[model samples]
Target chain A: MSIPITESITVIDTTLRDGLQIEDRVVPTALKVEIARALVDAGFRHLEIGSFVNPKKVPQMADTAELYRELGSLEDEGVTLYSLVFNAKGAQRAVDAGALQVKLVISASEGHSRSNSDSSIAQAGDRLLAAIQVLKANNVAFEVGTAVSFICPIDGPTPPQNLVSILEPLVAEGAAGVGVADTIGNANPRMVRTGTKAVQQAFPDMPITVHLHDTYNFGIANVVTTLEMGITRFDATLGGLGGCPFAPGAAGNIGSDDLIHLLHREGYSTGIDTEKLAGIRPTLTRAIGHPLSSKLSTIPAVPEPAPIGRASR
Target chain B: MSIPITESITVIDTTLRDGLQIEDRVVPTALKVEIARALVDAGFRHLEIGSFVNPKKVPQMADTAELYRELGSLEDEGVTLYSLVFNAKGAQRAVDAGALQVKLVISASEGHSRSNSDSSIAQAGDRLLAAIQVLKANNVAFEVGTAVSFICPIDGPTPPQNLVSILEPLVAEGAAGVGVADTIGNANPRMVRTGTKAVQQAFPDMPITVHLHDTYNFGIANVVTTLEMGITRFDATLGGLGGCPFAPGAAGNIGSDDLIHLLHREGYSTGIDTEKLAGIRPTLTRAIGHPLSSKLSTIPAVPEPAPIGRASR
Candidate 1:
């Protein structure tokens, strides 16, 4: 008998943007484009290619425009390219660069908002509205991401009502979608499911994407819960790269290969090639001069056939 | 207004027993005693102190009797010490060594049972019955552990009916309590909840302990889900130590310090000194010859205040 209620998941890789943010060395615009192409080739349909933030703040994203130009030229069919933006100015810059979508991040925790964005929820919502207006004017799809939606490292627990309150204005302002980020990776599966269900109930039609970090090692579990909650789109990094330079205890994003393997194993359709994604770990390892954090990077000694039986089998 | 139902969780440190099973080197009996003492000192009420198995099969557990003798002399008033065994002889050995309780592990997965114990589920159950009879005759408390209860790495997903069948006989054979072990770390939180509820329903009064491995990085999430199901007791290793020496993908138990921190943060009373437990990582690191897999080992820049805020504030 077949198991009922299988899920279809979409993996959105953000290695070039968020992944490179944690790297000490600058990744050239060409290298970013190359990684983007590699992710696309690996069957990642949604790619948060880069960010349109100030070059001074994020020197690695200094070549965001150049990277976007290169990606636009590739005209990679079957891929939706996206860029992260902090404010209206960044949103405008992303639109000017012909970016298809832009993501604006706000913090759900007040302490995180003050420390990371220097704005309260109300002020952050204003900036988000302004950014959404700019994206709307340019006819670009936009997503508002609420960071520390699960738990904040600076502040203690994020009350669910606080998160729902913060999301209400963004949904009312006509945000194309919402991204819930466990910024400091403190979310457990129960918390993820609770928050996701609450958000889904509040905004029935709004598309929700979960951005998770592996700091506390709940990234994969949270992703699983999100999948069960009918959230298909997720944010992952190649080789589990990226952490916020500003956020203490911020570690790698959930590894693309690891996430894809999990999704595939759970009988979900994620379209990504696990072997190809595992192949790129060497390049990232060489570039970073250290091993990556993905468990799938090193092949286990006794390779059991994929669970659910391989499609070929 | 009260948000939800939360309960106190009991943490059972199993590092010296199950954790040592996966160690590259055989941990000295003295080291096991020291680790057990540390766990007890850190306010762990129950500890799986050692395993009474054949030296040829599991060299690391060969010192089980010696370690048990050492812990027996220790002045731990609150700690309920236990040892693991496979058959009646092992239970006799533990009872002779002054163990308060003994655990017999029965593998639910046929492939694991054959590989791990050279027996089938029925044979293992028969062995467990003999062991329980021996323990009961000696008036020593005992619990039955069902390994690979959720899923097995060797065999694919274990059907719940199969698990129920394996457990039913044990419950009838005078098992004081029962535990479910995610032997190869393949269980997600949903699986944990489902499996736990089923077993709970089958044996309502049987105290259930959940042993999780962080192989797929869902260990903590699984623990969280089990806790939500009102299952209190859990097994954790110091620094995420121990894996199945024979199981291919099984690596690292859920770290004790990490789990304690997570529970403490979620308002669950685990009674563990997080700071003292964090301090124990160094000694474990020295013994293991490298840093362990725990994320909480690296001291957070924002120092965690003493567990003084809850009751006092």
Candidate 2:
């Protein structure tokens, strides 16, 4: 909202993890690797493939460790695979998989924290602190992510102070990056700008990533605000694949295809190949067993994206 | 992209005209009247009720004259009603219906002009010129609008110069405003900013309204860019309820309900009541005989929109 965005951004494709976690059908680990590779071919260097939570609770992501190990070679190609770890057990799984990086997520609001995981923010932090031990023990670099960083479905509008409070403890534990999520996709641009500013102010040294859901179609606006504030890391699902099972009307992260198209059209290079995006979209539709929600996914046959006014970095 | 948006915006709801034009089943006039009234109650000062196109060509809008007459009293409340007119015959219909204002539209690109109206842009411009004589003869104020203002479905990206060339003649005829449309919704934010800026610079004394479709989900991002660049007039449908029959994969305009929510959330008021928006939405869903596409419509029950940091102009 303040500055014009000209810098190249790191778009984290979270299709395998956040996208599939809410689905009743569990995507097999091989198919997950295929989608992951398709994304890497499309030029995504950072990816969030799965979370190491309870397999029983999120059966779709039960193969997190396996998927992480399978895609481990991507690190050689300069691609960083990410997983969401909530506790020491999840952290142990990360270590077992030889993970290079992991995103440790805790809900910012008590209501979401309780619903997403049966614990309050304090209790989740203690679990995360323990998880850090396991991650540090194995030398895995971890980024801390907060769910409902902008607005909580259960509680209400989250004050920016609450986000800072929750992340203060985690960031102090040598977290490499701080992640803010609009878990319900209900945040206004102003709220996103203010909250993101607060997080940047609190931990100016930490790289900030904004994870967005398009439940209310405000995801792109939040993307605009976050980019304007000079923060560039964004987490999105390919073809908008994920939704929250706990939040009644949550939508998937904003579509990576759509976001990349916007970025490329605005002269920012994501290094992701837009033509290759079409190849991976059908796999998602066929595997997810439902029609996709991304705008590009619904089109009959869009010409491979036209990069208009591409800005030279 | 250059200015901070701090002004009140006029959101013109085109649900009755463009929203219903492509539907096979023509909506009864009574229902159209009911929807118009509901929009006015929601604080929409400008409403596009219908277009005076040939009944056989676009049967859905055959009732344009009737709807205009039925809602004539709203003009007393400072509500300016708009209808799309293509030729002198359409302009005659508007004058006969006691119209105070009308938006005369022509395609900006030759390919779209051929497909949409079976004529080239120059030929269609001549027809609009004829329409202007009839409008001026009756002293009815008019605004000139161009379809495919940013990109044509058949042609590639529209150069900004093309918009100015097509609009120059019409603007010279004492037109009150200029309307630029991304008729196919393929416009990215940069295209929108460049095109809109071209129009603003060419017609420095005139009001500019942008009509957008969401075929690519860039509508909201374009909305952000256009608003940031200080264009205050927008056109949208009630539930993302419009599409083009000639355009193979066109989606509806960005939803009025969704746009109002975004505007309100950003501290800008559209003079539209968000609470009343929900009540009128079901009427549209029922009339359209299909599920609506607005993000707000898809959600089971969105808490009435909250205007965070509402700005007072």
lDDT of 1 at A164: 83
lDDT for each residue of candidate 2 in B1-313, tens digit (9 for 90 to 100): 1124566989999999889999878899999999999999889899999988889888899888888779999999999999988999999999999998899998877778898889888999999999999999999999998898877767767778889999999999999999999887887777888889999999999999999988877788788878888889999999888988877778899999888888876767688887798789889888878889988888776664323223111
Off by over 4 Å in 1: A73-76, A109-111, A117-128, A159-170, A188-198, A298-313, B1-6, B73-76, B190-194, B298-313
List residue ranges in candidate 2 displaced over 4 A.
Answer: A1-7, A304-313, B1-7, B304-313
lDDT at B108 for candidate 1? Answer: 78
Query: What TM-score between 0 and 1 does chain B of candidate 2 receive?
Result: 0.94
- Candidate 1 residue-wise lDDT at B275: 69
The CAPRI classification for model 2 reads as: acceptable
All candidates: CA RMSD (Å): 3.5, 4.2
Instruction: Give interface RMSD, per candidate.
Output: 5.7, 7.8
lDDT of each: 0.76, 0.85
